[model samples]
Target: MRILVTGVTGRLGQLVARRLLESGHELIGIDRRPWDDAPAGIEMHSVDLRKRAAEDVFRKSHPQVVVHMATVTHLIERSEERYRINLGGTRVVFENARACGAEHVIFVGRHTYYGAAADSPLYHKEEEPPMAMTAFPELADLVAADLYACTALWRYPELCTTVLRMVYTLGPTGQGTLATFIRGPHVPTVLGFDPLFHFMHEEDVAAAICLSIERRIRGVYNVSGPQPVPLSVLIRATGRTQVPLPELLFRAALGRFGLPRLPPGALTHIKFPIVVDSAAFRAATGFQHQIDEAGAMGEYRDAFPAL
Candidate 1:
């Protein structure tokens, strides 16, 4: 299969493209920017979907499978710029994919789209309406990006769209709150609220993406890891001390310093737990990975020894 992958420079994108390439598929990768030591043999397209049309890449690759992995994880300083890159870019990717006659489009999204609240369901299904956008206005673009990919089916029924709603993904390249907290020396938590948490490994996520492409499965599916872990257990496993504090007091202190490390609007997730029911995807793909929380922390430690 000829596969065209967007955001090839991203860690997840690079890993997914590598797997597809190793499986003997023709690969074409694209990114707005380049990173050091790109994979060899795969053609890299230096195009920004937000700034210009991707028809050139779409026409040139002429892919049967289109993996849309490109995304803006961090909140860019400029509001309009962020919207263009995240939401606008997504619309363009699908537009070009359909234009090029691609058969399938694979999208990566977050489990948080279900919303994390006091009364939120412990395990979320794909049927739930997205509430995270309401909770976190900063995620509006991210949700919009997901909607753009899913709605492509209604707009173009011939295109098969796979929406993988991922939960707290952590990897050397992952920038999620879970990954960052694990890498830090100390973790701050709401005193008595140790919510259940689940994080997916980069390898596992890549494998699931590959499986979906191989099967050309359509519809939305939740992607997650084996078992759920508590916030306290996760911090202890990472060899980090938990600094329990009242939610209000902690927020006040964090505000003084602007929560320097975390991106704006992501602090809410640190307080709530959003777990997913990935059984549907697992049963269908039969996808499994060996990495667990212990391995995830080890990877972070190796990346930053001082932590």
Candidate 2:
């Protein structure tokens, strides 16, 4: 299948593109940032998603499958730029994909939609409803974009759409609140909270995505590592000292001193478990995480020796 991948410059994007290419799929990559060196034969287009030039990629690639990967996290301030890059980008991608008559459009989302309710389901199914938006304001744009992906299903019934939701993924180049949590030398946690977390390795995420596309699976699917680990276990495995603080005090200190911070909307996750059930995805695509609990901790330690 001829495929188009947006945000190919990102670590996850790069891996997904490489995986698809390895399977002999013709690939076209689009990213606003310039890539100095991309693998041979995969066409690269440098242009912002909200720009007119971005549409040319769809026209050029004539993609049968479009892997939409561009998303703005809390790293970008909560401003118009973030909204445009995320929400606008999704709107633009969907519009262009339909215009180009693309058959399948797969959106990569997160399992955080379930939120961090203390009593939330330990194993979340793909069909589980999202929270009522009590917290996670930093994720508003992301949630909006994710919901927008669903519109493609009914509005453009001819188009095939799938949402691949993964839990926190860790790898050498991965970044995000969860990634930053493990990056710090002193891992902080709520005094009495030890939430269960499922962190998939970068390679596993890429493989799951490739399988979804190869199998032409539709609907939403959650992906994660083999098992969920307690936040305490992860902290101990990383050899990082646990700095337990009152939840309120910790946020205040982080804000006042500009200390190492969790990615926006991550405070809730630290206090409550937020994990997804990956059985549906595995059954549908024959996908299973290649890394186990011990291997996951080892990979993380090897990547961040100082932590």
Give the number of the best model, judged by lDDT: 2
Candidate 2 per-residue lDDT over residues 1-307, each given as its tens digit: 8999999988888899889888999999999887778899689999998888989879877899999999876542467788788888998998999999899999988777677886787788877777725676777777788888877778888888998888887766636556676676777788898888888788888898898898998888888866888998887886666778898887766633334655556688878888788888888888878887767677777778752
- List TM-scores for all candidates, in order: 0.92, 0.94
Pick by TM-score: which candidate is best?
Answer: 2
lDDT score for candidate 1 against the true structure = 0.77
RMSD of each: 2.2, 1.8
What local distance difference test score does each model get? Answer: 0.77, 0.81
lDDT digits (tens) for residues 126-215 of candidate 1: 988888776677778888888888887688899998898987766667366567555556677777788888886778878888999887
Candidate 1 lDDT at 153 equals 66
C-alpha root-mean-square deviation, candidate 2: 1.8
- Please report how far candidate 1 places residue 175 from its true position, in Å: 4.1
Model 2 residue 175 lDDT score: 60
